[model samples]
Target: MIRKANISEIDQILAITKACGERMKEDGIFQWNETYPNAEAFQKDIERGELYVYISEDIVLGCIVISTIMDEEYKSVKWLTPNSNNYYIHRLAVHPKHQGKGIARKMMDFAEELAVQKNFVSVRLDTFSKNIRNQKFYKARGYKQLENIYFPNQSEFPFYCYELPLKK
Candidate 1:
């Protein structure tokens, strides 16, 4: 069950992100850390009504941000669908306890469905360059890898951007 997250659910979402950050650090995936995706960022997502939480029997197991808002940082990258409006996925995470249960894939499926429903042209995301697991995941989903960008606080290594075009 995926639904828009309310401002009241901010703390729960933050907890999930914090736990995810810890797990990523443990796994040596520095995509997120103490500085990124804090409460303020989630608040912005909630305000924009872009944050979607995956819940089951009232338990929030995961969340993903699906929005058309383009980040200024993305301007430097050469995107496949540069001129088209597209859905972007950010801060997508499944609780460690719920990992390997296809939750992330389900959230992505939902994102793609929403994009199609909205008549969007494509889906865009940036994955940690060092996270081979996620790179494989996106590639298997037909997302073409594009230019690399960096999140200075997250890592000095480049983050590869990917796009999945909905149009043939």
Candidate 2:
């Protein structure tokens, strides 16, 4: 089951995030190396009602954060269309032990469903250029890649922004 994250799930979320961060670092995915999605940042996301968790049989399999609009840091991007009603996705992480089971794709489907229910037109996300697997995953899921957009923190590394139009 996938649902909105509660405050009680913070510890588990942090553990999952730390593990994912470590693996990304070991695999040379520099976008989220040490500072992108930390515990404090996720806590703030939860407090702001942007975090979502995927659970199965009482265990969390993965998670992601969805927002109605991005922060000012992302506002400068020319490709990021300013649609207040569109959904923005970030901080997607799957438990290493639970990977290869399509959990991330399921979470993305859930995000689209939520966006549709909220009357949003589309769902947007950004992934590091070095994370080829992630880029392919989104592309396979029907997200279109926008050129020339980079994450504010990782300016050294460019990012490919993707958007999936949601059904009304």
Best by lDDT: 1
lDDT of candidate 2 vs native? 0.82
Each prediction's whole-model lDDT (CA): 0.90, 0.82
Model 1: CA > 4 A from native: none
Residues 7-41 of candidate 2 have per-residue lDDT tens digits of 88888887787788778778987766567677788
- Against the hidden reference, what TM-scores do the models get? 0.96, 0.89
lDDT of 2 at 157: 77
lDDT for model 1, on a 0 to 1 scale? Answer: 0.90
Q: Which lDDT tens digits does candidate 1 get at residues 41-159?
A: 99999999999999988988899999898888787777777656799999998888899999999999999999998888899999999999899999999999999988888899999
At residue 140, candidate 2 shows an lDDT of 95
**On a 0 to 1 TM-score scale, where does candidate 2 land against the true structure?**
0.89
Candidate 1 local Cα displacement, residue 6, angstroms: 0.9
